[model samples]
Target chain A: MKFSIQKDRFAQSVQDVLKAISSRTTIPILTGIKIDVTEEGIKLTGSDSDISIESFIPQEEEGKILAEIEQPGSIVLNARFFNEIVKKLPLDRIEIEVMNSFQTVIRSGQSEFNLNGLDPEEYPHLPQIEEREVFKMPTDLLKTIIRQTVFAVSASETRPILTGVNWRMEDGRLVCIATDSHRLAMRKAAVETDSDAEYNVVIPGKSLNELSKILDDTKEPVEIVITDSQVLFRAKHLLFYSRLLEGNYPDTSRLIPTESKTKLELNTKEFLQAIDRASLLAREERNNVVKLSVIDQDTIEISSNSPEIGKVTEQVKSRSVEGDELRISFSAKYMMDALKALDGTEINVQFTGAMKPFIIRPEQDDSTLQLILPVRTY
Target chain B: MKFSIQKDRFAQSVQDVLKAISSRTTIPILTGIKIDVTEEGIKLTGSDSDISIESFIPQEEEGKILAEIEQPGSIVLNARFFNEIVKKLPLDRIEIEVMNSFQTVIRSGQSEFNLNGLDPEEYPHLPQIEEREVFKMPTDLLKTIIRQTVFAVSASETRPILTGVNWRMEDGRLVCIATDSHRLAMRKAAVETDSDAEYNVVIPGKSLNELSKILDDTKEPVEIVITDSQVLFRAKHLLFYSRLLEGNYPDTSRLIPTESKTKLELNTKEFLQAIDRASLLAREERNNVVKLSVIDQDTIEISSNSPEIGKVTEQVKSRSVEGDELRISFSAKYMMDALKALDGTEINVQFTGAMKPFIIRPEQDDSTLQLILPVRTY
Candidate 1:
């Protein structure tokens, strides 16, 4: 392929595709980024078997000639070294041309780089799925759905299915849930989709995180296509595909508490600060457990103790409390994560008992909820 | 000990002393910070054997009560955890009191921390240095002196003295030199010092780097005290002590050439950028060598070629070049370091021959110089 493209446009497209580049050298061809030039634009593709990212750079943008194609062909180049050279090239525009043997030549300003390129036929092809089960959602909503639940997924590979976030659609509402068995996060939103379509899929949390990073924060709509095993998200000039995790996701509906005996409404900021200070001491302990004690009708105490290090106690006032005097211990990290996922100024936490799991939800909205199992502290 | 101190003041002092705390558990006592309180104020000290730092919180400052000592005593606390606790505490003023048997209670706002403290008598005492051989220099100058030469020190400990920066005082001028055998950096400055007492001492590059970080970017003077085996720097309420490296440093005077066969002057920024681009291709090679060829009086070519990674060629313009057509190869990293150390916009590079070492200095002033040995490339 012979082409000349502007440096910045090419750099951005390369970066988008590089998100899927395989860092492992076990599969030699997978470590390369495949480039194809056509009359319309240049397409860049990178895949690591689990996820694939494809970005296209158009020929013209804002009356500037971004790329001029002489011949349409394909070649795969090393992703890392190619990206570094393109970033450091000291010119506004770059010229790239490939020889008959797939030797690539990149020229900018007074600097020129010639690299050995591999045949595009050696690279793995991306599976193409028919766009029958497709839906549209706002980019911001999709990113939020991914961020709120991805962190709760089990990072350990013991239960491969638990390492993925479960997504289910019913009655035009999309629900995303993830749990590592210790804590759980759930978010629900109304995505624009056909009423007849009902879908359930589990995508690896690590892939979702990478996809979220590549998603731009814009008001544009993102089109998602789901197959039997692969899901694709297309936004602007970028296409992201992730493989679905196998096996059934455990029923999380029964994990959330339906009722509580004690409830407290507190300002999220004040509660977060109190927990942060209490966590300072708890983090020194092995289990990172902090206790919460509710007293009278207006005061809540957060405390943590480590026998070898120290103990810290903090008092935080609540907006309203209608609960029996109680003391409960739970993972400080879990409480901090649940608080961060919430966006409301005031949050309501419901407690069943010292041993039973507790629920945290926004005071004004119940669409999002977090549940944490309290640790038994003797 | 009992005292109340402003949170900001206490936090700053704690941070300063925490720098000396060792993260390694090899020296258990070095992991803790020693605290001493008297009628005057409170002193915090942290030592890791190689370096010691002490920061004092005065009884009053700017007509405001920074600290009030109710009783005089001493104790030691774990530095890392204590610094984190103090930084996260939610109060403008904090009160700390020592209970029976070294238990310390730290209270601020509605939060309280009860930390286990160690008896201060077990902490190592800092060696007292006589102030007879002393001098003073602005903190900024001292920091600059350290930065310009520290990078050239040999990181390998094969030759102990090569890992340190050689500092010498002669004829009221302080000269600092660091060489890793491949490259050398020398900087000299006139400072007010004891003319009768000419001194030579080698300090470890790591210690100088830490000292430079602790010095503020103000014009305040820092007192320097030199002893038989240690050096002390006092600035404001902070005291920094570093152990001197023992051993005879190699004589580097004969390594620098006094005469040159060719000279070239170019803009430092442009030359550095050209070398940076050229190095991108050479980075994959074993030695990362970039070659410079002076073809004429106005233009110079910088190039690097790797058998597997291709070649890069960049042409840089020069203000003046009166050299014989010469081609020399050297490490891109060493050249970049020399360019970064140049204090002037234009730099003059003097080349003695193809294989001899070259000198790089500012065109206006030559007090500071950098030398790089050319690689023998067949």
Candidate 2:
């Protein structure tokens, strides 16, 4: 491969692909990034078995030439060193050439680097997914959906399927759900689909987390293609593929209570800050549990007591409280996570008695919901 | 302590004293910060044996009352938890009261915390240093001197004295030197002393590092009092005490080269960047050795070669070359460290021979000098 490309453009593409590269991969070839220079553009690919990313830099962009290719070829370069060299090079343009024995030479200004390249043929090929069922959504929307649900996914591998977020199509809306057995987060959004076909797939939460980072916050559309065992996301010049979990996801719809014994509406920021302070003392304890008790009709008391370290009590004013009086205890971390994901000035919390699961939702929008199972502190 | 203080001021003072609290200390009370509320003001102290910091918040500063004392008492609270509580409290003014059984109640707005406070009598007392000889310098200058020399100190504990920076008063100038035997950095500055007394002491590099962090970059003078076993730094309302390293520092004056076989003047930034790029490849090797060879009267080539990963070569323009044509190899990290310490647009590097030590100094200032030993590359 012989080509000269704009240094900044190449650096960005390399960074995007690096998200899929894992230094601890069992496969040796997977540790390197595959670079292919073709007539169309330059493609850089990185994979770590579970996810694969390919970022393409076009030869010409917006009537301006970004790359000039003299020969068409492919090679695999160590991702770690290649990335460092590209980021630190002091020049506007970079020239890369592959010679005999896969010797790659990179030059920019008065600096030149010679790296040992491997045969690109040894790298695994990306999974092929038939585009029979595809959905499109704005990049920012997809990012928001991922952020709202991914954090609730089970980090422990005891139940492998629970480590992924379940995506399903119900009617015309797409719903994403994740739960760690203690708490659950769900988000629903409207998507453009080619058919009325319903689909359900469990994608590893880690994959979604990485995808969210690479997705730009622009209004541009991202096309998603789903198959039996794989899913592909294509956006402008980037393609991301992730493997689907091979087990059934637990049905979590029934876990969220539909009825409420008590309801309270309060400012989101104030409630979040109250729980954050309560968590400071609770964190010293193993369970990180904090208690919330309704006082009178318009105030809520949040407190956490550590037998050895002492206790903290905070009173937060609520806009309105209705139904039965209640006191509930739950993980401060879980409540904080749920509160942060709901983007609203005010939040409505519904408690179905103290022992049962409680639900939290944005007072303005009902598309996002969070549920937490209270711990029996008594 | 029973008092109400401004939250921001209390938080800042708590953070400053926290630098002296080490979680890994053997003494349990050392992990806690002592709070003393006297009629005059409130004082916070944290110590980790090697270093101790005391920050005082007076009742009134410049006619503004920062704290109101309701009761006079002393207690020690866990630094980790106290800092977190102080930082997250939701109020402008904080009220702290010591109740029966040493149960301290901290209140701010509607938030309250009850912490288990230890008896202040159990906490170790700060070392007392006699005010025999004292030197004064701008806090910013002291911070600058520490930064310029601390990085060269030996990180290994094999040579205890080498792990500390040697401070000596020579010919009315305060000189600081640090060396790991491989490289050395020395900085000198004039200071106002009460007497023309000659003093020599080795202060632990780690203590100096923390001291630099707490010292504000202002024109306020920091009074440094030196004793036989301890050094006390007093600035405004803050007092910092550090135990001196007990050992005889080796004489490093003979290590500096007096004559030079070759001399080169180059832009400091360009030379630093060239070495930085060369180090990328050198890092792959065990020794991290980079070679610099003068190509002609005004050009030098910096290069590093890893047999398995290939090599990198960079050509940097020099302002002037004198004495002789030479090629030498050295640790890229040490060279980068020395280059970063010198504050100048251009630097003058004097090489004694291919295998001997070389000196690097700023072209415009004689206050600081760096000497590096060359690595013999066969």
Candidate 3:
């Protein structure tokens, strides 16, 4: 294989694929990145068996020549060393050539690096899925959905199903939900699809987090194809694949409280700041709990106490507070996360009682909701 | 103690003192910060036995009022909690008052915190040094001198003395040197001192690092006083004290080689970049060794090799190479650090032999010098 390419564009593509490569993979060859050169262009593939990422570089882009190919072949090189060398090459253009016995030489201005390459034939093939029903959504909207719900997923491995976000798409409407039993986040949006097929798949939260980083904040449409065991997200020049978790997600619709004995409307920024300050003391406790007391329509007081350290109390003014007065305690971290994800200046909070689950929503927005189960305090 | 102070200034002072306080101290009281209130102003102090820092806020500075003292008293509060609370107070002005049983109340806009305070009497007293003769230097210059020499100190405690920088003062000139037995960095400067007391002392590298962080970049003069066991650095509103290491520093004047077998002049940046690229492959070796081979009166080639991994070679043009051709190997990290510390555009390198130590100096400057030993590579 012999090719010369523009240095900056090639470096970016190399880094994007490297995010999926893992040093601790069970298969040793999976730790390397495979480069395939064809008559059309060059494709770079990286995989750790669970997640695979592929990025392509066209021979010419926008009437500008990016690469000149002398031969068509394939080679696999160490992902770590390849990235480090590519980024530090002294010139704007670099050349790579493969010799006998898979010895690869990379040359830039006056610098050269020779790396031991692996046989590409030993690499595993990426899963190929027939595009039966590909759905599309704006790149920015997909990133928002991923950020809103992924943080609520369970980090523990005991209940592996809860470690992923459940996606259900039907009738052009898609709903995504993630819950760790104590707290839950749900977001709903509309997608563009031509087929009538529906998808109810669970995507690992780790995969969504990495996907969010790769997606840009543009209105470009991303086509998603889902199968029984594999899912693919296709962007302009990149392809991301993730394995589906094989388990039934728990039903969370019944867990959200429908009735409210106490209702309040407050500024999200004010509430979040109060909770952050109160948590400073609460952080000394094992549960990291803070208490909130509503004094009718007068004020809302947030407080935390530690036996040895001390206590803190702060009062925040709210837009309105109705129904019976109440006091409740919950994890400060959970409340802050809910407020931040809601991303609204004004939020409406509803509580059935101190012990039951509470739901929070952005004012006048019914498509997003957050639920938290308050902790019992004596 | 009762006082209302400007929140921003108070918060900055708290952070500065907290740098000296450690949570894992052997003495329990050392974990708390002592606040002393007097008729003039308020003083905040933190100490970890080896180092102590104190910041004072006068009642008024210039024509602006910074604090309002209601009474004169003293108390010690947990350094960690004090800093966190002060930084997040809701108002621009915060009031701190001590009530019965040493219970301190901190109040801002509508927020209040009650903290358990310790008796100031139990806190260890700071070392007091009588100033017989004090030396003055530009604050910015002192910071620069500290940065140039501190990184060369030994991180290992095997030879405890090597972990500190030796400061020798005589005839109004001060010289500092640091080495870890492999590489050495030396810096010298002139100070304004009237006393003829020739002095030599070793200051802990950790102390200088912390002191550098607390100082700001300015041309204002800083007063430094050294005694038998302690050194004090006094600024406008801050006082920093550090304990001196007790040992005799070995004489190193004879270790420098005067005769040279090869000499080369090169651009500091170009040579540094070449070595950085070569180090990418050399980093896999146990010693991180990179080789430099000079072609007489021609370009210099830098290279590194690993048996398992490949190799790299880069050629950098030098201004003049008047010495005999030679090939030598040394640690790339030491060379990079020395180059960065020199901060010069053009540098002159002198090599005595393949086995002897070599010295690097900024062109036409004699106040700063770096020396490194070559490693034997078969």
Q: DockQ of each model against the real complex?
A: 0.76, 0.89, 0.82
Mark the 10 consecutive residues where model 2 chain A has the least summed lDDT. Answer: A278-287
* B-chain TM-score, candidate 2: 0.99
Query: Between prediction 1 and prediction 3, which has the larger TM-score?
Result: 3
**Candidate 1 lDDT tens digits, B1-378:** 888888888898889888777798597778898999998899999999889999988898778778878888888988888898889888888988989888999999999999999888899999788758778889998888888899999999989899999989888788899999999999998877754578899988988988888889988998888877998999999999999999888999999999988899999999999898888878866478999999788999999988776777888899989857789999999999989977889999999998999999998886899999999998
Q: Per-candidate RMSD vs. true structure?
A: 1.6, 1.2, 1.2
Tens-place lDDT per residue, model 2, A1-378, is 899999998999999999999998888889899999998889999999899999999999999999999999999998988999999998999999999999999999999999999999999989987768778999999999999999999999999999999999978799999999999999999999868888899999999999999988999999998888998999999999999998899998789898888999999999999999989988856489999999968999999999888999999999999989898999999999999999999999999998899999998798999999999987
Q: Which runs in model 3 stand beyond 4 Å of their true positions?
A: none
User: Best by DockQ, which number?
Assistant: 2
TM-score of the candidate numbered 2? Answer: 0.99
Instruction: Give stretches of model 1 more than 4 Å off.
Output: A62-64
Candidate 3 CAPRI-style tier: high
Locate the minimum summed-lDDT window of 10 residues in model 1 chain B: B190-199
List chain B TM-scores, each candidate: 0.98, 0.99, 0.98
In candidate 2, stretches whose alpha carbon ends up further than 4 angstroms from where it belongs are none
Model 2, range B96-180, lDDT digits (tens) per residue?
9999887999999989999998889999989988768788999999999999999999999999999999999977799999999
* Lowest lDDT block of 10, candidate 2 chain B: B280-289
Candidate 3's displacement at residue B74, Å, is: 1.4
Clashing pairs in 1: none
Clashes of 2: 0
